[model samples]
Target chain A: MVRYKAVIAYDGTHFNGFQKQPNGRTVQQEVEKTLQKMNNGEPVTIFGSGRTDAGVHALGQVIHFDYPQERPLERMRFALDTQTPEDIAVSSVEIAADDFHARYHVVEKTYHFKVQIEKPRSPFRRFYASYFPYPLDLNLIRQALPDLLGTHDFTSFCATGGAIEDKVRTIYQADLVVNEAGTELTFIFRGNGFLYKMIRILVGTLLKIGNGRIPADSIPEILAAKDRNLAGPTAHPEGLYLAEVKYK
Target chain B: MVRYKAVIAYDGTHFNGFQKQPNGRTVQQEVEKTLQKMNNGEPVTIFGSGRTDAGVHALGQVIHFDYPQERPLERMRFALDTQTPEDIAVSSVEIAADDFHARYHVVEKTYHFKVQIEKPRSPFRRFYASYFPYPLDLNLIRQALPDLLGTHDFTSFCATGGAIEDKVRTIYQADLVVNEAGTELTFIFRGNGFLYKMIRILVGTLLKIGNGRIPADSIPEILAAKDRNLAGPTAHPEGLYLAEVKYK
Candidate 1:
């Protein structure tokens, strides 16, 4: 068998999420179906970089699977495209080392969340951005990024309870950028790893800081508390995008 | 009664067209549905700048309609937003002079057609651009524009038969621009008027010229012949966009 790695981009508006479920279409399910068609009725299980919540998008998601036979990259891509729906586009495909794993070798990941502050927002962007009517103070949020940039227990930022007891994760960057139009604000996070809904919760907390619901200085206190209730509500899923996955 | 003019934008991927008909969901149908709801079930007809074909997007389509009452622009815009689908956006709305007519106004209109030469195209842009695999000679297209730009009897460029016998129109500009990545080519046409399928046919002919199917000098002679068969075929509608409509 030959192992292959692929970079995929998907419009997640209609998808339940990236993982397979008993009901509803998922990105993983679609890819598996394509693989099954190419593998003569044998369904090949594929491994993804990570899970993305429902309504989230991705531009450079990575995945891997083993195939029974080795083929040229172009022919494999053609077979994949012929079966995959238009909502999901496989951006790149290549053969991988037998030991290469899509999830284990990841050294960094980046997620971007877009907030649209424009009033009576464009309908065309309804599925891609979160609409927030109130004006936000950019400087306040900028001032708070340092507190969330280092390694810390992200329990307050993750969904309350899971089997995993450790909520510690290292964040290398927390950046906020406003597009040229000044109508949209993007929050970017790059980290070694992220917990369930962690980035969304951080975004929510930062939005509160920008709107004066909480001051920038309150971030350290929230981080110290390590309680989910201390942070703001999780931001909407539509605005989130898994931008990149890096591995050495 | 108050006359209002609005600038509209829509992703025409799911729309039948701009004109209202007995069947199918058209942009006119959706706008009229909103107006009907606002006007106490008294359906108000709107005059559009022109009809955009099915699967053709518009970023700055203009329309005018009469309403029973004069209210703040904000309220009207809000009401429209509440009823329109996510794929359509009423970007701007304001009161217009009673004498102003969207269709009869004398001004320029700009249409843009995008051709993507990139392989492994993104799924997010599935309906926004047409994918052309062949290498196009941009200089050849640029060399042919001077022959087609300016006042001319454009009978050969338009669809064969129409109600109006006068096929004369003046083109202010026929510009070809390539995106920074060089993967996409955009044909921009600004003119006082365009006949049915005129811009699409022009793009089709230009694509032929760029690909060596026809020589640059053939344009003037084709325009003079007044024969539709002599010109290139009409390009696909998906790549066409009603970029803007202007009136002073």
Candidate 2:
């Protein structure tokens, strides 16, 4: 069997997310189906780095698959293109070790959340960004980032169905950057792993800080609470994207 | 009456171009409806620099409108946030002289046509850009630009439309720029006025030049032929955008 690793990019608007589903269309199923057709009607299984919720997007998603062929890599790329839609693309492909499972080999991941504060809508940036009419306090959100760093319990920042065995995760970085244009705000996070709805909840709490509903230093207290109810509402999934993944 | 000149921007994916239509939802109709609502049911006509075809986008489309009430321009900019959809926006508003006309007093107009040349789908950019799977010869397309400059009969380039009294138009600048990343190709055209489908025809013939199907010098001969049948196919409308309209 020939093992291949591919870097993918997708607009998640039409997808139910990355994972395979029974009824709804998914990025994984579409790729696997395309592979099956290329292999003359043989179903194939492909492994992805992680699961992105519905409506989320990805710029550098990594994946791995095994196929019983000794063909050149270029032909495989062209074959996949012939089978997939215009919204999903295989940005890169290469030969990989047999043990290179996309999920197990991941070392680092990054996520970005965007908020457009201006009243006028941006014509070119509508799909990839989220619009918020209310004004936000940037200073307060920036102050909370330092406390959220380091290994700590993030239970308060998780939504429902967060059944991870460990709630403690190390956040290498969490920073709030006011866009140079001054009309947008971006929250960037780098971590070992993320819990269910953790990033969205973190964004919601920061928004509250911007709204003056929650104190900037209250993040530590919320983490100590270990109660999801104490955190603010979850932000929308559209503005979130899997920017990159790193492996050792 | 307060004369306001606004620089508008819109993602034309959901809009039927820049003009008002009796049947379909148009960018002009939507903006007009919003303005009427804000003016307490007052009817106002907006004059755009030019009419963009259906499915075409715009970044710096200049327009002018009249209102009897004297209010801060910022209020009108903010009011559109609640009145219009996320795809359209009034980027800026300013006071202009009574004699200033968006269409009649134009100095220069810049239009850009964007084409995506990658194999995989770019989901986020699917609606805003045109996708072409085949590779293009950029140098050959560039070689054909010199013949397109200066005044010439443009009957072969334009579509059959309302009485075209003047068939000669001067093209101050015409060039095809390949993005630094080598991922996108944009064709920019600057002139006083354009006939129906002129840009699309120019693109079609240039594409033929790139494919070696026609020589670069064929453009002047095609102009001399004064027959539309000698030209290549007209390009799709989705790839075109009215980038800017300048007036001094």
Candidate 3:
């Protein structure tokens, strides 16, 4: 068997997400179906680096799978791309190392959460950004960003109902980029890994701190408390994007 | 009665068109509905600077109406914004001078047509831009642009079935902007006024010239022909936008 790797972009607005669920179509299921067709009716399974929730987009999502036969990588890419839906584009395909695993070998990953502040909702950004018409105190948000860096237990930021036992994760970088107009806020985060819904919850909590609902110094208490109730609400998935996944 | 002027924006994906007709909802119909509600069931008629075809967006569309009673301008703007659907927004509203007219005494109107070349479809821009998967020779397009300057009979560019006798129109600044990535093209046109689907037809003809389907120098002949049959196919309305309107 030969291992193949592929890079993908998808609009997640109408997708059930990257996982194969019983309810409806998903990014994973679509790719698998394409691969199965290419393999002449044989089944194919793909492993994604991680799963983004419904309505969360991905610009540089990475995945890998095994094929029983080998051919030119470009041909496979073209064949797969032609069959995928218009909302999904498989950008690049390549042969992978014999033991390469998409999820296990990742060294860094980045996610971007976009917030449109005080701007009228744009037809151009409806599915791409989350509109927050309320006032945002950027100064307050800046003051609370540093506490999220470095290795720490992120239980408070994870989904409240998930069964994952380990909650410790390392965040390498977390920063904000405000557009020149000051009407858009982008939360950029790079980390070793993230828990389920961790970035969204973290952004939500930080927004609360900026909005004065929570104190600037309260993040540590929330993290230390290790209680899901201590964190702010999860932000809308529409604004979240799986930007990049790095491996070497 | 107090006359009012307002700047409006809308995503035209699902709208029938900008003009009110006997059947279907239009930008005009929606605005009139909102105005009637505000006027306590009294109907209000508005004059638009011009009409945009179905699936054509607007960023600075202007309209004027009259109210039986006077109230704070800000209150009206807020009320219209809050009551309108998410796809439409009344950006600004104010009292107009007694003689102010939306369709007359206009100094400038700028329309922009966007074409995405060799870029993946974006869910956000699905309704806002047209996609063309072909190679374009920019040099040929630049060579033909000068013919569109100054006042000339634009009968060849207007829709064939329209009965407007005077086809002469003056085009001011017309240019092209390609983003740094070179994956998209924007055609900007500012003129005194536009005939029905004039911009779309011009873009279509220009694209044909650039792609070698038509000769660059043939533009003057096409203009002189003053016949609709001399022009190329009309471009898709999804790519056109009423970018701005100015009156002084």
Candidate 4:
């Protein structure tokens, strides 16, 4: 058997998420189904770098699978792309080193949150952005961004009552890009792993700061408190996008 | 009575378009319903710049409505925004001069068409854009663009059996912007009016030219033929957006 790595992108609007579900359809199921159909219904399992919840999207998601037979990378890539649904595509395929594991070899990941604070909704960017009619203070959000970078115990940001006991993670960068079109907040985290709903919670906290509900400099205190209630509400999943995944 | 002009925007995915239908739900109907609810069930007829077809979105659509009593623009704007569904919003409201007509006073209209030619469907942009698998040659489309500009007969690009009899109109600009993200082609036409499906048909003709199925220079001949069959199929409405309306 040969191990192959595939770079993929998917629209999560019509999907239940990245993983396969017992009842509802999913991105992984769709990709696996396409591969199965190509191999005459031969069952194959794919491993992903991480799982995204429902309504979440991805631009550069990485995954790997084992095939009983060997084929050229270009042919496999084309076949997978042709067989996949319009919402999902296998962008690239390559033969992986025998021990390459999609999840275990991960070094970092980046996610983006798009917010449209205009009075009138954006016709073209409606689906891609979260609209907030309430006036947002961009300066406050920017002021609080630096507190999120670097290593920290992120227990305050994780969802309440998760199985995760260890919440330490390193954040390489937290960048905020505000333009006339909209506000795009990007987070680049280089960590061993992340807790459940961690990124969403972090976004919620920052949005609260923008909304003036929380003080701009209260992020460090909230983190130090290590209480989920100290953070802001969990943001909508539609605005969050898995932008990239890095592996060593 | 006090009259106010509103700049509106909506995502046409869940709406039936700009006009209010007898029984069907439309963006106009929804806004009107919200207005009536705000006014204790008092009905008000709202007039828009033009009728946008079902599934066609708008960014800068202008509308005018009359209120029985004096109302603050900020209050109405905020109330309408709060009451309207997430898909629609009233961006701005200004007390217009009594002579302001949403349709009659329009000097120019700008429309944008987005085609996602890249691999990877963006979940966030799925509802706002159309995906095309085949690669498009934008250079050829650009070469054919100049021929369509200026005042001339455009019967070949207008939908057959429409209400308009005059097909002659001036097209100020037909700009094509292609990048790594996707193809964003915008047409800024300065005309008195447009025929039904004229823009869609023009896009289809340009797409055909881009695909090499039609010669880039044959645009003038197609226009002079004054035949609907001379043009290609109408581009899908999902990719179309009314970007703005310029009023003098």
Candidate 5:
């Protein structure tokens, strides 16, 4: 059997989530079903780098699966692309090392959170961005972003339900970019790892800080406190995106 | 009674069209339904600038309706904005002259058609753009656009469903803009009026000329011939947007 690694992109609006479940439609289930059809009705299991919650989109989500027979990479990609739903696309496919694991690879990930600050929210962007009607000070959020740039225990930023005990992770970058129209704000984060809903929590806290609800300089104390209740509410999932997954 | 003119926008992915019919959900139905509720359950009807086909989006579609009461414009806008589905938004509302008509007083209109030329189309754009995998020469399309300018009979570009006999229309502007990445093209057309599916047919003919299936200089002949069979097939509606409507 040959192991194949593929990069995929999906619009997650209608999907339940990335993980497979019996209740609702999911990206994994759709992809696996397509793969199984390609494998002549034999069950095919695929592993993703991580699970993205419902309504959260992905630009370069990575996955790996083993196939019983060898085929040209382009042919496989074409088959997968044509067979899967239009909302899910296989961007690239390549042979991977037999031991390569999509989930276990040691590397980094990048996420983007988009906020629409325009009043009377745009209909075209309603499903893709979170609307924030409150006034925001970008400088305040900029000043507070540095506190999250280094390795720290992110217990306060994690949502409950994750089974992982260690909440410490290294954040390589945290930055905000505004579009030319000044209507949308994109918060980009790159890290070695992220706790469940960590990015959403961080964005929520940062926006609160920008709006003066939370003090701009209180990130350090919040992290030191290591309590989930200390952080701001989780931001809406529609605006969150898994942008890139780098495996080394 | 007061005449209210409003500019609305919609995603149109789930909408049947801008016009109300017996079957399928439409933007007009949603807006009228919301307005009726606000008008004490009295049936309210909205007159749109024009009808857009299924899957065609809008950015600045204009509509006018008569209301029994005069409420604050902001309050009316807010009520309509909040009550309509998330896919539709009331951008602006104002009191208009008693004689002002949404469909009759239009001086100009602008429509935008988006085409994605990237291979293995991006999933995120599946609902908003038309994917063309063939090779296209933009210069060819640019050269042919001038033939479509000035006044001309556009019967060849008009779909057969409409009963309008006067197909002569003035083209103010016809331009093609490529995104910075060169992966997408936006075709903008400003004209006094358009017939049924005119923009889609024009885009289809333009793309055919760009791809060398038809001669780039044949636009004049097609317009003069006034034969629908001479033009290319109508393009997909998803890429078409009713961008703006103007009033004198």
Candidate 6:
């Protein structure tokens, strides 16, 4: 058997989430179903780098699976790409060491959250971005961003359902970029790891700061509090994206 | 009663079409439903610049409707914008003269057909673009575009289901624009008016020429024959967009 690693991208609008469950259609189930077809009726299980919540899109989610036979990388990629639903795409396929794991690897990740700041939101962007029509002060958000950099225990930002005990993670980058038309804001975050819903909460808190609902200098206090209630409400899942994953 | 003119945009993936029909949800039905709520439950009829087929999108579709009261234009625009589904947006509302008709006063219309040439189509663009993974020579398409400009009986390109008797239309522009990535081709056409499925058929024929399935120089012959069968197959509706409607 050969272990294959693949990069995937999905729209996430129609999917329940990246994980497989009996109740709803998911990215894992879809990919595994397609792989099973190619495996001559044998079941093929695939492991994703991590689970993305429902309605959260991904540009470069990683996965790994073992196949009974070896195939050309391009052919394998093409087969998976054409067979899966149009909302899911297999971008690349490569051979991986037997010991390699999609999950449990030492890595870094990058995420992006998009917000449409224009009034009366755009029809075309409704699914891909979160719409915010209120007045926002970018300078205030910028002032609070530095407080989020470096190592921090993100218990205040993490959702309650995750079983992770260690809340400390290193944030290498946190920045906001506005499009040329000034109608869209994109939040970028690169970190060694992220807790469940952590990025969404960070974005929500930053947006609150931008809109004057939260103080610009309150991030440090919020982090020190180690309480989920101290953070802002979680941003909508539609705007969050798993952009990249790096393994060492 | 006052006539209100509105510029509308919609993502047509979930819509039946732009016109009101007995079956399926349409953009007109949604807008009319909202207008009815605003008009004390009285039905308000709207006249559109033209009908767009099911699954075809629009960026600047024009419509005019008579209302019982005259409200601020921005307020009217906002009311309709927020009330409609997330896929539909009312961009602007204006007071129209009593004699100004949405369909009759139109001067020109711009339509765009987008084709994705890249292999393993991007999931994010599946709904917004038509994927064609084939070798296409853009120079051949460019060479044949001029034959489609100026005035001509476009019966060869019009689908047969329409009841319109006149098939002659003046084509003001026929251009193929390739984005910087060279992965997408946008076929833009501005004309006095278009018969049912005319723009889609034209794009289909142009893409055939680009791919060498049809001779690049046969456009004039197709126009002279005035036979729909002579034209290439009609392009997919998802790629077609009614981009703009102009009034004199």
Q: Which 10 residues in a row give candidate 1 chain A its minimum summed lDDT?
A: A118-127
For B27-94, candidate 4 gives per-residue lDDT tens digits of 88988888899878999888898999888888878998888777878998989877888778678889
Could you tell me the TM-score of chain A in candidate 1? Answer: 0.97
The top-ranked prediction according to lDDT is 5
Better of 3 and 5 by DockQ: 5
DockQ of each: 0.63, 0.60, 0.41, 0.45, 0.85, 0.80
Expressed as tens digits, the lDDT of each residue in B1-248 for candidate 1 is 89999988898889999999887899999999889988999999999999998999998899999999999997888788668887777878999999999999949999999888776676766688877767688889999998878899999999876787899999999999998878788999999999999998999899889989989778999998999998988988988999899997
- Score every model by TM-score: 0.94, 0.84, 0.92, 0.89, 0.99, 0.96
- What shift in Å separates residue B212 of candidate 1 from its native position after superposition? 3.2
TM-score of chain A of each: 0.97, 0.94, 0.95, 0.94, 0.99, 0.98
Alpha-carbon interface RMSD for all candidates, in angstroms: 1.8, 2.3, 2.5, 3.1, 1.0, 1.0
By the lDDT metric, which is better: model 3 or model 6? Answer: 6
| TM accuracy, model 2 | 0.84
**Residue A233 of model 6, lDDT score:** 91
lDDT (tens digit, per residue) of candidate 3 on B1-248: 99999999888888888999988779999989989999999999989998888899998899999999888878888898778777788888999898999999688999999988864455445567787777799889888888898898999999977878899999998888886778778999999988999999999999998899999899789989988888988999999989899999
Error of 1 at A165 (Å): 2.3
True contacts kept of 5: 0.93
Candidate 1 at A132: error in angstroms? 2.4
In what order do the candidates fall by DockQ, top score first? Answer: 5, 6, 1, 2, 4, 3
Give the DockQ (C-alpha) for candidate 6: 0.80
Tens digit of per-residue lDDT, candidate 3, span A161-225: 78888898888889999988776789999999999999999989888988888998887889999
Higher-lDDT candidate of 2 and 3? 3
lDDT against the true structure, each candidate: 0.89, 0.84, 0.88, 0.80, 0.95, 0.93
Residue B69 shift from truth in candidate 3, angstroms = 2.7
Better by TM-score, candidate 5 or 1: 5
- How many angstroms is residue B79 displaced in model 3 relative to the true structure, after the best TM-score fit? 1.6
**For candidate 4, lDDT tens digit of each residue in A108-226?**
88887777666555544555666666767879988998888888999999997777677899888787877644544444444456778887788878888999999999999999999
